[model samples]
Target: MKLQQLSLFLENRPGRLGAPLEAIAAEGINILTLSLADTAQFGILRLIVREWDKAKQVLEDAGWVVNLTEVVAVDLLDRPGGLAEALKILEAANLNIEYMYAFSLRRGDKAILIFRFEDPDRAIQVLLDNGLHVVDGDELMSFVP
Candidate 1:
């Protein structure tokens, strides 16, 4: 299972972030999850939305640098060591996690962790074999907050 994450390159200016959000809103795309990783001069806005393709086109049409990446969204318990348990499974498989972010899913008891790994397919298979539930783009988008 994989979700399409939109990576939008934004300059470190006041309205830089607003433009992308505005574009998404204008396109009527519902953002399920978002995180902004910033640097001194720029930032990368990663987003999971209701309509991946439409959101991407809307951003590109507005002249923003956008890219789509497949990220694995694993169901985790919303408590201590929940993430550790998941990582342990990945570590056992020798899969390296490049980056990851967490958010509460529509189902309150579970958390959604989006991970970018060295090998996504391998990671997915490993998690699946271990009985870790992975959600796809559509399912992830349906998650609240």
Candidate 2:
């Protein structure tokens, strides 16, 4: 399936990153994986957190602008060449990867990689056809260490 990701535009200053996390924490939400991209003046914080609705609400309530995007979460091997193999599959299908980040638990062996693609539906089908496990948003929410 797909994962719900929160993207927040923030100022490139001290403690800017902590503000969103603090707001999310107030709502008792847990962050699963995150990616941050910044420019000279501003930054974008992309996060995969538990309780998507509440996390979004909390951030908005705290006067932060946020957007929701659907991304694919695939199970990844915790070894070398694992990611490359998956990328090859997508490449073979002409799928373009916009961005990606890794997710791993402290006590778990398996890892998850969050991917944003130009054509998510087709990418999902390609990954599934290649025998890769796509994680659902709900399943990721209940994931524990």
Candidate 3:
């Protein structure tokens, strides 16, 4: 199970982030979840949109350095230790998590976790065997914000 995450290289300048947002908005693609990892000069804006392929194309045509990455999406209980329990499973399976971010849907009992792991296939199987629910890009996008 995987979702397409758009990673755009953003300069630390005014309106740099706005362009991408506007592009996606213009195409009627709703952003489900987003996170920004920044430094002094630039940052990476990771976005999960309702339409992955369209969003990617829109961003690229607009001259943005956008890339599509397959990330794991897990449904976790909205409670304490829910994340810990999932991490424990990944850790025990020797999966290295490169990055992760999560968000709660407007009407749901579970939170969606987006993860980039060292070994995606193996990690997916491990999570599945361990009883964790894994969702794909289409399924995950269906829960639009």
Candidate 4:
């Protein structure tokens, strides 16, 4: 299964990051998970949200450059080497992960990892074939605050 992720290009300066976040908050949108990677001049803020379309709209209307990316959410055990085990499976299948971020729920002994892969559909198949649970879009939204 694949989910849509929001990527925002923000300048790497004080107060620049909060503007987009505040815009989304004003509309009552919930951020599921996010990752920020920066360079000298700007940063890429990758976010997972349930209401992606609305979030994108608000950010863009506020003058932020936003992009939609297809990403996969995979469920893994919340234990040591759980990620390593999944990585080994992808390695055997020759699937490359471009980037990933993870979050663990307080109620379950499981972790949800958002992954951007070179081939998302193929990666999902490989993960399923290897007995890994691939989180679907609806299931992911259920975890949103």
Cα-based lDDT for every prediction: 0.85, 0.86, 0.86, 0.89
lDDT of 3 by residue, 1-145 (tens): 7777889999988888898999889998888889888899999999987778899999999999888887898888889999999999999989999999875463377887889987789989999999999988767666564
User: lDDT tens digits, residues 7-125, model 2?
Assistant: 99999999889978987987778787789989999999998877788899899999999999989999877789988999999999999999898775622656788899888899999
Q: List the residue pairs that clash in candidate 2.
A: none
Lowest summed-lDDT stretch of 10 residues in model 4? 101-110
Instruction: Sort all candidates by lDDT, best to worst.
Output: 4, 2, 3, 1
Best by lDDT: 4
Which candidate model has the greater lDDT, 3 or 4?
4
Best prediction by TM-score:
4
Regions of candidate 4 where Cα sits further than 4 Å from its true position = 104-107
For model 4, residues 1-145, the per-residue Cα lDDT tens digits are 7899999998999998888899999999988788998999999999988889999999999988999999998889889999999999999999998999884353288888989998999999999999999998898767665
**By lDDT, is 1 or 4 better?**
4
Compose the digit string of candidate 1's lDDT tens values, residues 1-145: 7788899998988978887898889878888888889999999999988788999999999998899998888888778998899889899889999889885454677877889987999999999999888987667555454
Task: Quote each prediction's TM-score.
Answer: 0.92, 0.91, 0.91, 0.95
State in Å the error of residue 141, model 4. Answer: 1.7
